[model samples]
Target: MANDTNEFWGKQAEPFRAFFDMQGEAMREMFGQMTPQGLSGAIPSATMAPGDMAEWAKVAGELQRMWLEFVQERAQKDMAGANPMDPAQWMLMTQSLAKQVPMAPLESAQKMAGDAMQMWQSVFTRFMAGGDPEDKPDLPRKDRRFADPAWQDHPAFALLHQTYLMLAEYFTKAARDVEGIAPDKRKQLEFATTMLVEAMSPDNFLLTNPVVMKRTIETKGQNLVRGMQHLINDLRRGQLTHTDSDAFTLGENLAATPGKVVHETPLYQLVQYSPSTEEVYETPLVIFPPWINRFYILDLTPKKSFIKWAVDQGITVFVVSWKSADASMKDVVWDDYIRSQIEAIDHVRDRLNVPSVHTIGYCVAGTTLAATLAVLARRDEADKVKSATFFTAQVDFEKSGELKTFIDDGQLEMIGKLSSEGYLDGRYLAATFNALRGKDLIWNYVVNNYLLGEDYPAFDLLHWNGDVTNLPAKWHRDYLRDLYRDNKLVVPDALSADGTPIDLTRIETPAYIQAGKEDHIAPAASVWRATRHFKGPVTFLLAGSGHIAGVVNPPAANKYQYWTGDSSAASLKEYVEGADEHPGSWWPHWLDWLESHGAKKVPAKGKRKPGGKGDKVIEDAPGRYVKTR
Candidate 1:
């Protein structure tokens, strides 16, 4: 192994020895001026000031300048066969650098500097001395951004790519090495820096990205012209274009689940879907999706729609399509939504003439549903809902994930100010969620649509994602304050809904809590905490993907895996270790669980009118409320 390592470095070191010597000399030169008294002098032993984001920009700019100068200046003179830079070639190094942690001890700084020097040597050697490129890419399997042939083959682009990745990684570590700050704040710093670094990746820019450059050359800059037009159109449309919006219509293609609006309120439209099976479960299923986005996500396409699948599997489905809240709705609170939920359940029960309905909530709606159930329990109406299922929902915010970054006092104050119109703008939530996975949701599109000028595809999911919705200001504030920030929802009676004190522990409703292993919005750990509150039979399942795709995974696709039978464990980690792994979607597992929990099959209703005569059809499914925006 040592011989192999030596052999590899020996080959690389031979051609760029002088280049390495000069670059190492350059680092030492900078280190003399930038050194901490010994390292903390230049780098503080404490965390950087929370407000001093400008400092990150400065440090990043300095590194960018030094690297560009070092490579452009001495490489041609020092390294054999090293390509000499032209004015056009120098333009390739274009992106501005971002911030990093401002502190480190002298020894650690020096050691990092040495490590960086070695990485610099290796990349330079590979770019300049290493002539022939390999047939396959050296990039991580997941990051396809640099898979283009020119990125690996061209010396200048290769230099930029390798250097950017190395620096991004180094700074990622440095961002986490902060001292004297709360773990949360440090994590915020690290997340901010990571996002900044990713945002400024070479591939994100047209000049630095080989694929975009190739497209430009091929199209004679027509791609840029078209992309600019797309930018202007999107800007005019008041949102980023994530999909070909014209490709799918609400009732025509997307959200095409057959159903009719049986009930309507100021808050929501209750769409009771037409049953697909001859005999369906006697107890109907009522879904309350998060108003943070539209409810169509549960019915994206027949291939992926969980609602459609459930209906086909002999379950009558009723979904609540929440109105896009505006000034009038801004005065509403969490209690109001709970009341509305109760009203919807009553209507479904009266129309179906059933005792109770199987209730389900996704994301924030699930969080609130837990509160509603508790309220029902407190009121001695526990039998109102036969079963409760939460999809990637966090009832207890104690173990909340990245979304908490937006809930601090300072940020909440800003949000309140922005919500002067009585409701928080949907765009704010859109931006917030986008930030959680900005590399994919935001930057990737920036590179593809704006830089590479690729036309956005017709994707049902992205369309739903882009279809943002507003939250009432007071309700939003109360939620952030009570549930997320204070974490009162899971603490017995710390919170209330519609004047009823919520005590989750008092609720004995059978629960099926499904969490995604990769869920960022509602992490598995946070979701798992709900199991402790359910006095009834609790079945916790962990799905394979993130919040959306994980839950939306269909059986026919046979994509991803799921885990079951580890609810006995105390934590998500322990549960995962002991859980039974199932191949494919968790849908089937959930189906069995629902039936076992008493989703009895009987003659299907709605041969003439959907939900029978009692439930009058107001309009078709994917009704007016969903089409409002």
Candidate 2:
């Protein structure tokens, strides 16, 4: 090689290069010492190894032949191009081939080693820190975290745990691999290598890297500091403007103007309905939103929120705004939720003077709706619910996606153990759900806001995620035992909300079920299985994204792809009828159906304009509850 100054490598690379050269010298010295000491024949039976050596030689020859062939093929490609022998061009070819090699396995191996060392250390640390798993406190009473059916059988979590175990094993094996290495050379080669490997490990680097962890602490401190700054900003702005009935009107447009609130209804003003307004539609719409999130996601912003779309399409909507559970709501159960929904429906009935209503149940709310539907059907009150729409809802448990991994006999029993307390805590459920998406959701937060000192806005979506609600223990236990463990929702004679056999066939209302193609909670196939149980006209729509994104999806963006089967043309089986085509977002198709069912404009009953006598309005569009946690 021509003598050249090390211009390509910076001063930082020198220490690494020097260390590498030292390792080679150490290896040579180690071999020299062993050769004369007669310890070099340490490998199993050198004399008997001749036959094995011959086989190895044969394998080496074949590998060389294959490698030569590969080089020749590449050489031909290079020769075909102009300026074939240019050294720089050849370097590019070499680099391209080098890039194709899979380095993740090597990276993973190092990670395994580091994780093993940490786990070994943790045994001692846990003892000192009093963090032993056995010392963990018993499940709390009134903890809603235990009640979520997803807890019993979450698949993503199971995968993460399995990955963790494999990493541990890999680490232990690496330590063994280096054990046979000589001690004198160990410092030169193995020690530094171990340190470097440990430094880059997922556990060490991600879980507890001093540099990264310090940055995280700094970022969190900065966030609090910034929060204080925002409070100051608010105070300064408050001086310029005035507070109008607990609502602060911004003097400066510091936040993005018209920052859209998605997947919820506007509740800026207290909702008011006059009983004197005569009904135009034959049936009204009563939407049930999950207590886990704010009710308004369905009516988020003007054009995008499902509630807005439905209202614009001329459907009379009444959404229940759930109050955060306190000691007063401690005794609530599945029956209570059912009663609340019924009471809301009654309110709509009294307001519009309508006979029956169309009930749309979303996420976990759908399960509650199914129970109510069954109760209504048994009492021959089917006239109460004109039709039902389930958005990303699961009635069948067999193929319920990753959420199932958290459920099993053991987990359910554990939940039952926890429920002796009054309510299921929502904060715990939020933490676990956040854990499920640790790499993307949790780690992303750590790196972005914590490590990078970035500021995320007080967006409505984030706010809703922050605002969590508790679940009653009795309700949650039955939910898990019936829905997840036993797959009771679809079975006619399966255990019911009240222990009476739930027969979904009796819930014969026209049903429209929608699920996302990428939904991790409830798969499309699981939603499609509703056809087998419900005798009603079942319409299955497969949307494009995940649970939340798919439902909040709008037409103006026009990003998603979805499919829907004929509601009455035939059963879900016969409707496909060899059709192998894909359709776009279910939003427009749903809008069309809603328009067909929607009543044309009846005269504005009360007044042409607001008398300001009705419940106060928040803003023209997006509401207050969504903006404020």
Instruction: Report the C-alpha lDDT of model 2 over 324-413, residue by residue, as the tens digit.
Output: 444445566676777666666665565556677788888888877877788777778777777788887777877776555445554455
Off by over 4 Å in 1: 1-107, 127-132, 135-143, 606-615
lDDT of 1 at 211: 88
TM-score versus the correct structure, for each prediction: 0.81, 0.56
Worst 10 residues of 1 by lDDT: 89-98
- lDDT for 330 in candidate 2 is 50
* Best-matching candidate per TM-score: 1
- Residue-level lDDT tens digits of model 1 in 19-108: 345444433432333222322233332565644334443443444444455446545645322111121211211111111223432225
In model 1, the Cα lDDT at residue 525 comes to 87
Q: State the TM-score for model 1.
A: 0.81
